[model samples]
Target chain A: MKKHNYSAGPCILPQEVFDKSAQAILNFNDSGLSILEISHRSKDFVAVMDEARSLALELLGLEDKGYKALFLAGGASLEFLMVPYNLMKEGGKAAYLDSGTWASGAIKEAKFFGETVVVASSKEENYNNIPKGYSVPADADYFHCTSNNTIFGTQMKEFPSLDMPIVCDMSSDIFSRVLDFSKFDIIYAGAQKNMGPAGTTLVIVKEEILGKSGRIIPSILDYEKHIKAESMYNTPAVFPVYASLLTLQWLKKLGGVAAVEKLNNAKAELLYNEIDRNPLFKGAAAVEDRSNMNATFLLNDAAHTETFDTMWKAAGISGIPGHRSVGGYRASMYNAMPIESVQVLVDVMKALEKAI
Target chain B: MKKHNYSAGPCILPQEVFDKSAQAILNFNDSGLSILEISHRSKDFVAVMDEARSLALELLGLEDKGYKALFLAGGASLEFLMVPYNLMKEGGKAAYLDSGTWASGAIKEAKFFGETVVVASSKEENYNNIPKGYSVPADADYFHCTSNNTIFGTQMKEFPSLDMPIVCDMSSDIFSRVLDFSKFDIIYAGAQKNMGPAGTTLVIVKEEILGKSGRIIPSILDYEKHIKAESMYNTPAVFPVYASLLTLQWLKKLGGVAAVEKLNNAKAELLYNEIDRNPLFKGAAAVEDRSNMNATFLLNDAAHTETFDTMWKAAGISGIPGHRSVGGYRASMYNAMPIESVQVLVDVMKALEKAI
Candidate 1:
């Protein structure tokens, strides 16, 4: 069976990226040293760090725009704590928009450091749509939002340009689409989806947004310190950063973010169209807010569930089961997910409907 | 030239461990999936996590001793903060022995959470010797110490048997020797040194010592939470843990820590004897406290520096340069370092002496 992976991270990466990364692990850049064994400070690995940081900026088209990129360990979960620790000061409020589970998680951590205000939330609707018309308070230090909800399959179509700094968690759909990167004061993502692997996280912060928090942040949580250390504050998540660098290089070779978004849209459209037409399935999120990255849906009739699952499994599909909270199906069509895989899924759904 | 990797951390590993790890990164356990692409929640990676955590306890001789082992992201640097975050309480003092750089770093973070008392320190001697006859206060909530100093080449030959909890930073020389597993309440090591590679840290904690701090620890920093979640509290440093698992398996196959320790001591003795015997070289640390893992030394005559350096470089030595705080040389002979490599380094020293 031809494998079609749709796991929600440590997710899909370009096959070329995986091949190159595997080679590097064996003998990094012909250094005759396993990438696993080399010093993080060595010239070979340092070049990897430099390239990963610079290429991240280059792909976001944020280079020379007062933004610095960093590769750090601890993933987006750590970033939840760090964003508030570095940006939200004592006695100050940070506004948040809670659309789904990850957004609520961010809010929970931010409250530990300072005052957190949820201006709007879609949770009352089970987070099936993005929160609308949220007002950012002028006195708030920063406004936090999750750009995409991985489990609920809802993506923010337009970011709010607020008077305060805007921090966004773009973990699942980071490079899958084009975005106006300049609007974000800070952007962070775990490298498991649309980037590379799981160990490292990418943090891009605009310089001016730092140093105003007036709280004593730990060195590990301090963004300025990491930026000053060139992301070598401690021995970094080396392999993941190197793998992400390769993916960034692949993104550049495929004509950068704009080019990749086109294919992503085509893939999402193909799958969603099949879901709507077949009557056997229905889309989970609001049609306008449906993620082009993760397409969440469900079998219209519960009786078809086992049959459809068996069909997809026989066709070599994996990780299509939705999060327990959502209780349906989520086909994550990340950047590395080719249109053919979407076609395979769409064809399976059609076949199931025709047989019924 | 053949490579001789002697980096202080991210140092060296058994060739078979590296070979097996490299294969897993390409196709983990023949799952036909790159370890990089697989979901950590999958059965394949879950087995990896289970094996790594279990083998860590087995190698430490702490299995079934109520100690829980966890693999986490961030190196020992993060452990510096986590140790205090989980164990130290408000208005209580934690006694510490400041042996070297990492111990001081651990002290710095501990102070943030509680009153820290430095019971002893070797800073007066430029950290070249481990402090002796230090009293661990009974009233202190815990006693913290660094077991080995990578930069200074000092190792604690014996630990203080105290009434309170004992936390050790064994980042430099973990598993290179045997010890009474029940003596300490907590042991943490970065994977880069004697274990495997950079990125992940191994944390072994006694179950009873946790949840006493009364501080609201973040989920990422809370040891109890990680233990309860079986180190799946967050996505782990997958590749590093996988690599470390292979190294641990290699250790067990080589008859475990007792066997590896013998080889480690022989390698260290080979290099230290050369440092003492060669007219141009001298060992740095006090003889009794010198580390078996990192053997720090200096050139007696500065003028011979270039000649000696050239000799070692020509003989395929790498990363033997001493840390800036203690300059000259540091030949880190970790568990995986073969006695032949030490012989090669010793031969280089003798060749330099003959040429002079």
Candidate 2:
């Protein structure tokens, strides 16, 4: 069966990246050293690092500016704490926009460090919509937001224009769209989603935000520490970062972020359109705030859950089960997700509707 | 020219693991979904998590004891802070045996969290030997030690047989020898050295040692938090851990740690013997402390450095350059090094000796 992956995160990567990355791991750039074992300091490996950093800057339009692109070892979960450690000071505050599980997690991490005033929260609406009309804290260190909620299938169409720095966890929808890089101070993502692989976390941070925290941050958790060390504070997850770099190169060759966003939009539209028209399936999140990355829906009758799962699995659709938090069905449409995969998922929905 | 991989860390992997790992990243475990893209919660991936944990236990001879193995996202460098965070309490002093660079790093991190007493240090001797006659603190929270020094080839042949919780940073020497699990409260290592890859850090901690620390650790850095959550406190570095699991399975199939150790010893013996015999090369570390993993050596004549590097590189010998800290040459004969590779280095040294 040609399995279509809809599993949320540690998610899919471009096929080209996989092929190239694997080849490198076996024999890195024909150096006869497997990339998995090469020294990060070697000329060949350093080139990989340099190119990865360059590609990140190119993707985000930060290549010319002084923005620093770093590939960190820990996943975004580690970043949740690292962010507050770098930015928030004693009695220092940050405004948070809570939309879903991940957003709440970031907020939870921040409270331990200092004050985090939630500027907007969509929990009142069960996280089916983005909260609006809350004022960004002028005195806050920065405004933190999750760009896309992986489980809830809701997204921020535009970042709030804030005078304070902007820290966005774009883990789910990073490469899914085109955006101006100037609006944000820090943009981070786990590579498993819309990048290349798991293990490495991508941090695009403006240099000005760091060194503000009076607390002595541990070397690994400090962005300025990594930035100064060129992300070689200790050995990084080399293979994953290399894989991510390859994926970035592929993304650039396919016309950078602009082309990726268009394909993502097309894929999401096909599935969401089917859900909107079908009587058996109902789109869960608000229409305007609905993610073009993850499409979540519920069956009209709850008994159809098993049937839906069985049908999808047999049809070679994998990872379509909704998160336990929002239980029904969710088809995550990441960048590596093909239009054909989404089409098959849509076809399965149609087949189910006819049978019902 | 076939590149001889001598680049340390992210250096080389068994070719078989590389091929399969790459294919899975494209489409995991024949699941037709990219391994990078799968949900860490899925049954297929959960098995990977479980198998890796079990195999780690088996490799360390720790299965019967209630030892919990976890695949953490942060590299060993982060474990520097995490160790003290999970074990140290206010006014609780830990006895630390500083062997080399990494041991010093661990000590630095420990100081931030609690009082850390340097029981003994070989820094006075340029870290060429593991300190002797050191007393392990019975009242101390834990006795921290680094098992192997990568840059400086040295190892702790026999740990102090003290009735104290032994916490070891086995980053470079894990799986290089068979360990008696009962002695240590925790054994942690970065995967790049003797394991599968670089991103994932393996941690094996006794169930009882956790929750003893009074400090409120950040969730991601807490061992107890990870154990309770079954190492799923956050999404792990799935692909790297999965690859490491496959390598573990390979290691077990090749007769577990006991079997691999013989091979490791033979490789070390061949190189150390050659260094001792050759007038051109002199071993750097103390005879008692020489590492069976990374072999540090210096040429008697500094001018012959280029000649040696050229000879080795031409013969496809790699990663023989000494680290910057000890600038001569280092031949890291890790777990994956074929004995033939070491034999070739011996032959090269012999040829150079005859010409001189």
Candidate 3:
């Protein structure tokens, strides 16, 4: 049975991308070498780096704009440190909107390099909705925000436009919709979610925003150095980058983000509608702020929990368990997740409601 | 034709390991999901992390000997900065042995954290030999060295026994031989040579050596934090770590490092003997300090270069081109390289001599 992958990250990739990446691992470009063992500097791998970088910008409609895309190792956790290490200067302050766990993580790391002001937070409500009506300080170096809360299942429908540089952590929802790309000076995503695998993080930074922090950044942590080296400043996570490139190609062939967003909306609507109509389940997040990518819900009566869990397991569904803090269910419908999988989950919910 | 792999890093891996890894990428442990898309926190991947960590220590004969092994991102280059960040104190100095490019790189990063003393170096002699009889300072925080010079083909036959902590960059020669595993306070190697792939780096550190620097260490660069996190401090490079786990299992099944050493020695001897006898070729490094992993050599007559290059290419041997700085050929005979492949290279050398 084809299991529906709804894991928050290292989640579903396009089937074709997975197939091509598997073939590459066996024999990369017929070089008789596994992609795992090929040098990052090799021509085949270099082409992968080039294509992945360009496709990211192209998909965001930021191609030929000032944005430069980079594929790097260490995931978003590393980016949490690097973003501040490279951008937040000594004695400077940055504004952060803490929507959920990842937002708090970024805020903690940024505090290590400089003063961080929580412009707004939904923490008071257990992050069940996106914060609003927070004022961005004019003196702040940059405004940082998480576009989607993977744990709370809340996503900002629109970013707050500000004159200062805007840095967004789009880790869980980058390619799932179309966003105004030029508004943010920096955008980063952990590849495991919507991009590729877990090893490489995708960073798209405007070149002008770097080196303004006046801190003596370590070369490895320096964003400018990575861009100068074309993301091969060190031996890149070659296989992950190659897999990400294949995924970007798949995204492009699926008519880029615009086409994928239509399917994503439909998938979310199917499950959200089921949760609304079925008496056994209730939605976890506010209806206005709920994430189209991650849908969180729980059994309305609590007695049907075991029955619903077993049904979903038998239905060949995986990773629908909500974050421990929420204690319900979270189905992360990334761009690669087909609508059929969402239908499966909705059908399970409807059947459980009828049977219970 | 089945080509022989000899590329330095991201070089070669066991055929069975490749097969198994490729299968995992398709459907990991019958979970009906690609390993490329599986969550890093999943039981399957966690098991891989556990097994790989234990196997590394077991193969090195350091199991339960106060050494903790961790898999991290960014390769050895990241370690160059992290080692000093986590180990060297604000007012202290560390001694470094500048054997080759990587060692020099480490020395440079260490200098950024604190004062560095070059206790020993062979840079004047083009790093063709490992320095001996250089005194390590008793007051230095730690003594750092590179066990193998991939570019110049020099290998330290024995480590300098000292009371101070010993940190080693064993990127090229790790797992190719058996060494006194307890002697070093820290051992780090990029998983490209003799291990698995390019994205993940293996770090084995003595627990007692951490948290002594007193400087504020970034969580990502903190070795103690990574060890506590069991190398999943963040989303690790999932595919590379999985591939590395497979390679480590392959090493353990092949009688561990002790058994692999015998074959490694044999392969080195076969190629070194051929280089000595062939008038067309001359070894680059000092015979006493030559690496069993990388054999650097040049044609005795530069005029025979095209002929020798053609002969090796025709023999289906790859990755023999030496570092541009060395301007010769480097046949890196890593652990996964079969003796039959080395014999083929030897036969090509002999054929070139005959034809010349």
Candidate 4:
């Protein structure tokens, strides 16, 4: 049975990506060498690295705009430390919006560098919605925010324009929707969600914002050194980067982020509309702030829980269990998740209402 | 014809690992979903992480000892920074041995944290030998060294008995030979040579050595935190870790490290003997310090280079060109490299001598 996999991260990629990447593992580019066995500096892999970097920028429509896309090891969690190490000057202050677990994690690491101010936090509300009407300090080195909260199922619809560099953690929502990517100086995403797999992170930084930190950054943590070395300062996550490239190529063939955004919007609407119309279920996040990629919802009454769960399982629907912090179900619809999967979940919900 | 691959790091792995990992990408463990599409927290993947970690310690004979094995991202280069971060106290000193380019790189990173002392250096000799008779500063936080110098084709035959904690970067020679694994506090290797691929790093650290630095380490760079998280502090390098587990299983099926050590010794002897007997070729490193994993050699006369290069290429040999700094040929025979490939290279060397 083909599962309608909705696992939050390290989730579904295009079927073509799985097929092509698997082939590369066996015989990469007809070289008769497994991609796993080739040197990172080989012409074939260098081409892979180059193309992945450029294609990332091209999809975001940030080409030749003083931006360098780097496919680095250590997922977005490591970026929490590197962001502060690269952007926070000695005794610098960084302002962060604590919207969810990951956003708070980044703020914790930032506090190690210098004064870290939480501009606003939805934590008191269990991060049920994006905090609003917050202001970043004018003198802070940079203002950081998470575009989407995977755990809370909330996404910021608007970003505040600030004089200082604006950094966004787009780990779960990058390449899913079309946004003005240039509005932020630094945009990063873990490849696990919508991009590729779990090993690599994509960091898109405007070159001008780097080298001003004044702190003595270690070479591995230094963004300037990585850019100077063209993202090969160390052996990159070779297989992940190649898999990401195949995913990006798949996205491009389907008309880039713009086309995918349309598909994603339709999927979100189909699921959200059902959640709203059904008397037994209610959305977990604020309707206005709900994420397009992940829809969190719960039964209005606990009586229907077992039947609903059994129905979804019988329908071959998997990975809809919500995070422990937010109890219920979370149907994650990344770019590769077709609307047909969302409909299956909706049908299960409808079946529950009828069977009851 | 199957090409004999000798690329340094990101080199060859067992044929079975390639096939099995590729199959996993399509439908892992008969789970109906692609491995690339499954959650890392899933039961199947958590099982992989547990098995990979335990099998690593089991093969190293470190199980039941106070050691923990972690599969991490950022490769061995990241370990260069992480080691100092988690071990060195603030305002402390570290002792290092300058054996090769990678060792020098580690030394550079350690300097960023505190005073780094070079206990001994073979750099003046172009890293063609490992220095001996050097004493580490007892008061230093830890003593760091590289067990194998991949670029210069030298391996340490003995390590000094020191009171301080000992750390070794075993990126090239790990799993290829038997060593006193418990003597070191921390052992890190990029999973490219004698392991699996390039996306993940294998770190074996003695549990007692952690959290003693008294420095506020970032969670990502904190080995203690990673150990506590069971090596899943964040999403791990899932595919690479799985492939490494497959390779480790392969090694065990062939009778573990001791058995592979015998094979490695035979391969190294087969090539080193030919390099010594062939009038046209000479070994690069000191005979006493020659590496069993990577055997670097030079043509006695540069005039025979063209013919020798042609002979090797015609014999289906690839990735033998050496580092630009050395300007010769480096045949890297990691654990997965069969002795048959070494024989083919030896035949090519003989044919080159005959043609010349």
Candidate 5:
């Protein structure tokens, strides 16, 4: 049976991505050697790394804009530490918006560097909505924000226009929507969600924003060193980068991020509309702030839980169990998730309403 | 035609591992979801992480000991920074043995934390051999060494005994040979060589040696945090970890590291004997310090380079061109390389001699 995987991360990718990646694993680029076993410095693999970095920037429409893309090894969690290590100066202050779990985690790491200020937070509301009326301190070295909250199912619709460098963690919603990507000086995402797999992280940094942090930085944690080496400072995550390239290629074929945004918006509308229209269900997040990538909803009455769970399982819908903190169902509609899958989920919800 | 792969690190893995890994990329463990598309928290993948971790300790003969194995990212380069962060005390000193490029890289990162003493260095000899008759500072926080030098083709036949902790970077030679295994306090290897691919790194650290650094460690670089999280503190390199599990299974099935060590020694002897007998070729590293995993050699006369190179290419030998720093040929014989492949390369060397 075909499985509709809505896994929050390390999540669904294009079927074509899987097929090509499998072929590469068996015999990469007709070299008769598994991609798993080739030297990363080999001409063929270097081409892969180069293309992956180029495609990541090109997809974001940040090409030729003084931005360099790096496919790094550690996930966004490492970025939490690298961001402060690279951007925060000696005795510097960084401003951040507390939006969700990941945002809070980034905040925790930032505090280790120097003074960190929370510009605004929706934590009082269990992060049900993106906080507004936040003011960034003019003296901050940088203003950081999480573009989307996967756990809370909320996404910032508008980013603050700050004179300081702007950084965004777009881990779950990087290529799923169209945005003025150049507005942010540094944008990073773990590849598992919309891009490819779990091993690599995509970091697109405007070169101008680096080297300002006077604090001595370790070579591995320094953005400038990675950019200078073209993300080959050390051995990179080869298979993940190649898989990400395949995914980026798939996105380009689908008419880039703009076209995918439309498909994604449609998928979100289909699922969100069902959650709102159905008497049995209520969306968990604030209606206006709901994430287009992940739609979190809960049954209006607790008695219908078992029925809905069984129905989704029988329909071959997988990984929709909401995060433990949210206590609901989260249908993650990343770029690769088909609207047909969303429809199947909605049909299951509809069946639950009738059966109840 | 079958090709012999001798690329150092991100080198050859078993053919069965390739087949199994490719199949998992399509559908993992009959779960009807690509391994790349599944959550790390899922029961299936959690099982994979557990088994890989357990197998690592089991194969190292350290399961019952107070040690933990973590599959981390950022390769051994990150660990260079991490080792000092987690072990070196505030304003304290750490001792290092400079054997090759990677060992020097580690020493560079160690210098960032506190006083780093190079207890012994073979750099003056162009890293042609491991240095001997030098002593580590008794009061240093810990002592560090590389078990094998891929570029220089030298392996440490002995380790220093000290009251302080001992850390080994076994990136190129882990699982290729048998060692006491419990002599070191910490061991790390980039999985690309004998384990799996380039994405994940294997870290085996004794439980008792952590949290003494007195330095505030970032969560990502903190080994204790990773160990406490059971190697899932963040999204691990899913595909690499899974592939590593496959390789470990292969090693265990083939009677584990001890059995593979005998085969590796035989392979090294066959190639080294030819290098010694062939009047045209000369081994790069000192005879007593030659590595079993990577054997670096050169043509006695530079004029024979083109002919030998052409002959090896014709014989379907790949990735044996030495690192640019050491301008010669390096034949890397990782665990998965067949003895038959070594015979093929030996035949090519003999052919080169006859043609010249």
Candidate 6:
């Protein structure tokens, strides 16, 4: 069957990006050595590393500043602990906003190393909206937030008004918009969503925020260690990093983040409008809190569930199944998801509504 | 230049493996979705995951065993920490033979989670040989060893004389030899070396060794967590895992570990013979302790370095530069390397000898 991928993460990628990436993996940058077969230190691989780092900074509008861009291993989950281990000082505290599963996971990892003050949480409201009236600690090490909740379809929408360092798990929505990165001291994301693949982690940190933690971090878990080593702290996730670099090149050639962000919103609105207009379907999260990347919804009651599922699958759309945790459907509209896929999904929704 | 890749890890791959892997990255298994874009939970992805897991067990000869195979995101460097995080009881002791860099790294991570006993250490001799005369403590939770040192070119060569549960980092030399799996409690390797790429880590662990560590492990760092979650506790390193699986398939079709081991022996022998015969080349590691995967040697005089380097590069050989920490040359002959590459290097050495 012709398939359109709507998987939440490990999600869709551009055809050009994948083609270029595959070629590189086989024989990187025409170096006659597969990206998979070269030293991370080779001049070719180093260029990949440098270009990837520079692009990340460029995407975030931090190219002129001295912020170091790193592609490290162990994903953002490792960064949860590493962030605290590097920046959380002895007797220091970090402010956290518990917006979703990933946010809570970050809280748990941070607690392992230092004290955390959860300034706001949407758990009481089932994470349908970003919490309001968060009390940021004036003396806190940093304020942490999950920029977009993939499961619940919520985004911070705007930067948290903070006087302290703001760290974010921008795992799902990193390049989806033109983010004002200066407001955040550090931003980390797994590459599965908007970046490339699932092995390397993209970290952008202000150089001045490091070296305060009293804890002795294991070398692999240290941020400065990675920055100093230029993410070749060890032989890094070479293929993933290389793939991510190709994707970045694709992003640049497609006229950068601003160009994609416009298309992304159009795709999101297409599916979201269908949900609002269709009688049988209702958006799962609050309209104001809807995620531009992942659209979550449920068939009103159980009667039309099987029908909608069958129609979408027959239309060659996949991963629109809602997370069992949320009990409905989620259409992950990452950058590579063409607007046509969303329109087809919208058509499926209308057909299901008419059938009902 | 048509480069010959001998880059210790992130080493060589079969041309066919790269071809298929590259195609899958663009469009996976004919699903019309890039491999990186698919949900790990999708049936197609699950099938890829299952096949890769099965192949790992088959390669290690663990089909009918009390074992579970997992493909994890963190490289073995992270596994160095995770092994103890999941297996070590609070204050419980583990025994480790400090063979080289990896073993020492693992030792550092294990000590953070529990008490660690260094059974023996070769730091006195810079880890040129596996330490002898180590007594395993019955009270020890597990015994750890690195199967081979990529830097020093030393391997365990035989199962360590131990009675406790055994764990090993076979990152550099896995699949280069035929070995009994009955002795190990857990075995892991970063995929960069013999398996495939650098993003994925392969683990074979007895299920019973889990649930012993009473601490709460961060979800991603927990091996037990990954095992329970079926290696998809998070978005996996899809591209590298698929490539590793393809490489394993290639190995299986080439007649499994035994046939590959014979070819590996011939490659190592050709280079080692040249080193022994040529007056210009001096091996850094003990002869008995040499690794079949990476051969470390120094030119007779530093002045001869550029001559041999130019000769090798003209012949399309690359990445034989030794690690800066131990400068000379290192010809890593991982499984993907054609023996002709080694023969060419051997011929280069002979020509250098005659020229001198």
Which candidate ranks first by DockQ, i.e. highest? Answer: 5
DockQ of 5: 0.90
Tell how far residue B15 is off in model 1, in angstroms.
Answer: 1.7
Q: Model 1, B38-80: lDDT tens per residue?
A: 8889999999999999999998889999999999887887888
lDDT of 4 by residue, A1-356 (tens): 86999999989999999999999999999999999999999999999999999999999999999999999999999999999999999988999999999999999999899999999998999999999998889999999999999887899899999999999999999999989999999999999998998899999999999989988899998999999999999999899999999999999999999999999999999999999999999999998999999899999998888888889999999999999999999999999998999999999998898998
lDDT per residue, candidate 6, B99-149, as tens digits? 898898899888777789998998988777878767888898888999899
Chain B TM-score list for all models: 0.98, 0.97, 0.99, 0.99, 0.99, 0.97
For candidate 1, give the lDDT of residue A103.
92
> What does candidate 4 score on TM?
0.99
Docking class of 1: medium
TM-score to native of every candidate shown: 0.99, 0.97, 0.98, 0.99, 0.99, 0.95
Which segments of model 5 are wrong by more than 4 Å?
Answer: none
lDDT by residue for model 2 (B147-262), tens: 99988899988887767678999988888798676688899988887788888999999988888878877877889889999888887888789989988988888898899899
Deviating ranges (above 4 Å) for candidate 2: B1-5
* Each prediction's DockQ against the real complex: 0.69, 0.69, 0.76, 0.88, 0.90, 0.66
Instruction: List, residue by residue over A1-356, the lDDT tens digit for candidate 6.
Output: 66777889888888877778877767666677777788777787888889899998997789878699999877788788888888888888988889999899899988876789998888988888988766787999888999999999887787767777789999999988997788888999999999998888999999888887777777788888888998788877877887788788888888889999999989988888888988788898988889999889988878777787889889998887778768788999998888988988998888876777
- Please tell me what DockQ candidate 3 reaches: 0.76
3 or 4, which is superior by DockQ?
Answer: 4
Q: Give the TM-score of candidate 5.
A: 0.99
**What is the lDDT of every predicted structure here?**
0.88, 0.84, 0.90, 0.94, 0.93, 0.85
lDDT by residue for model 3 over B1-356, one digit each (tens)? Answer: 87988888778888887889889888889878889888888999899899989988888989888999999988898899999988888999999999999999898878777889999889999999999999988999999999999999999999999988999999999998989979999999989898888888999999998889899987888998898898888888888888888888888888989899999999999999999988788999999999999999998888988888888898888888999979899999999989999999999888887886
Better of 2 and 5 by TM-score: 5
Q: How would you order the candidates by lDDT, starting with the best?
A: 4, 5, 3, 1, 6, 2
Higher-TM-score candidate among 1 and 2? 1
> How well does candidate 3 score on lDDT at residue A123?
90
Worst 10 residues of 6 chain A by lDDT: A25-34
